[model samples]
Target: MIHFDMSIFIVAAFLVFTLLVGICFSRQKTTFREYAVGNKQFTTATLVFTVLATLYGGGGLVRNVEYVYRIGLWWIVIMLLSSFGLWAVGRLALRMGPFMQHFSMAETIGNILW
Candidate 1:
């Protein structure tokens, strides 16, 4: 007599379903630009939301909360300063956007230097 775990079957089914979905939705032909940056048609609001989600997603929110609990309100000031630094870097990136047409950071740095 063999005992089988039902949860294993559920997980296997989910993995198969996810693989099928990915195969069905994947593009057949994709350029480097398209693969790297998508269509580049995102609106300002969409880009803003995406950036915000990336910044606050994963364990970042949890880590920040833990820091605040452990270290008091100064963590918030550190967060604000970090956000300001990010904003400044974003502005600098925008100014260098023209040099990044190929989406290569190395090329952009070379262009800036020379």
Candidate 2:
């Protein structure tokens, strides 16, 4: 009598499925512009939310809450200072908006260099 672990079979099946999907959907030749920005136009609010989500995703919110509970309320002041830094960055980004017509920092730098 032989015993097989069904979990291994399930894991292998999932990996194979994911690989097949990647191969089917991936482009053979992707331009840098397309790869970087997907040639998509996003509204200001959408871009803001996307940035916020990236910053706070992956247990960041939970970890911050835990730190507040263990460390004290002063952690919130630090968070606010970090947010002020983000505000400064936003101002710089706005100033650079004209130079980023292609929406890629590398492209803008290359153009400036050459």
Candidate 3:
């Protein structure tokens, strides 16, 4: 059987590699377009994981797991409902914020392009 230390080392190495890859791409040429955006050329898979982590936080997952443990396995529905509610609210506010004000709470979500 594989030892626990081996597994931990492999996971740590993989994380270091991933961090290097993302950081290597963070710096790029500076211009009105490049400087404003700062080279956000992420792959779709990376984008998916990034969005998932941001939208469904650690607290939400912890709560859902706790609910499932107490309620005996049907709490996934509650988790889904809560996630959907948050997504709906964000979508509505973002879709409306641009028209209402120059700098909305939704603007906080966007790039400042400085």
Report the C-alpha lDDT of model 1 over 28-114, residue by residue, as the tens digit. 778878888886878999999999898899799899999999988899888888888897988888876476575777777777788
Model 3, stretches more than 4 Å misplaced?
1-36, 86-114
* Candidate 2 Cα misplacement greater than 4 A, ranges: 1-10, 27-31, 43-46
Q: Model 2, range 18-73, lDDT digits (tens) per residue? A: 99988987957787777777776678899889998999996999999999998777
Instruction: Between candidates 2 and 3, name the one with more favorable lDDT.
Output: 2
TM-score of the candidate numbered 3?
0.41
Give the candidate order by descending lDDT.
1, 2, 3
Residue pairs in candidate 3 whose N, alpha carbon or C atoms collide under 3 angstroms: none
Q: lDDT winner between 1 and 2, please give it.
A: 1
Q: After superposition, how far is residue 90 of candidate 3 from its true place, in Å?
A: 8.5
Task: Name the weakest run of 10 consecutive residues (lDDT summed) in model 3.
Answer: 97-106
Report the alpha-carbon TM-score of model 2 versus the true structure: 0.69
